[model samples]
Target: MDSDSRLDLEFAYTTYRDCCRDLYSPYYYCRRPLGHDGVHAAGFGSGRVRWEHRPDHAPHLLS
Candidate 1:
């Protein structure tokens, strides 16, 4: 892949890792980020993460 595409993939993976760490944290219940609906909404309530690749850009996760 090109440099731009590699960068985009790295960024996406970093974001995904950070998100997973935060979502799975035990302290998330008491120290949740702003706008995070409670634990259930942030975790169990959501569907599986889906990654989509666009023809003109890098792949991204669909929330």
Candidate 2:
């Protein structure tokens, strides 16, 4: 990969790691309601998907 692409990936990974760490902090946990299954489900579901594309963007790119 090009240097620009590598730099972008590094920046993204660092941001993602920082965000994930923030989620586990006590301050973050205390703000949310208990038994919120949908919130947990959404986080779990997001990791399972490897790729995603919006239908609106697809048609423009394909043409």
Candidate 3:
């Protein structure tokens, strides 16, 4: 892939990773970045996270 495409892919991947790390669990579906700003906020469910979801990004429970 070209540099631009590669960057886009990397950015997308990073966004997805950050989404799972900052917004929800790895099992949750995370949308693409909402803005061009670096480290843009990620969205998961309910349009926004609830109080209980503040720690949604926390590590999953070991089973």
Candidate 4:
């Protein structure tokens, strides 16, 4: 895959991992980054993390 596509996949996989590993909200879905009926915040990091998501769900979870 292209670098951009690889980055996107990494972001998606890590978003799922971050939610399961860090987030402890009963409201947020832990299986993966998932949006609520309204919104759910779900991801953060920089450098190696290299990606972040934002609301609608939150981070990736919100959108």
Candidate 4 local lDDT, 1-63, one digit each (tens) = 964454445447654535433233434333333332222233333422222234343332322
Q: How high a TM-score does candidate 1 get?
A: 0.24
The whole-model lDDT of each prediction reads 0.32, 0.27, 0.38, 0.37
Candidate 2 Cα misplacement greater than 4 A, ranges = 16-63
Better of 1 and 4 by TM-score: 4
Question: In model 4, how large is the Cα lDDT of residue 22?
Answer: 24
Which stretches of candidate 3 lie above 4 Å from their native place?
A: 16-63
Model 2: lDDT equals 0.27
The model with the greatest lDDT is: 3
Model 3: lDDT equals 0.38
Compose the digit string of candidate 3's lDDT tens values, residues 3-51: 3454446446764434333334444332333333333223332443222
Error of 4 at 39 (Å): 31
- Candidate 1: tens digits of C-alpha lDDT, residues 1-63: 963454344344444324423332333311222333323113212332222223575323233
Candidate 3 residue-pair clash tally: 0
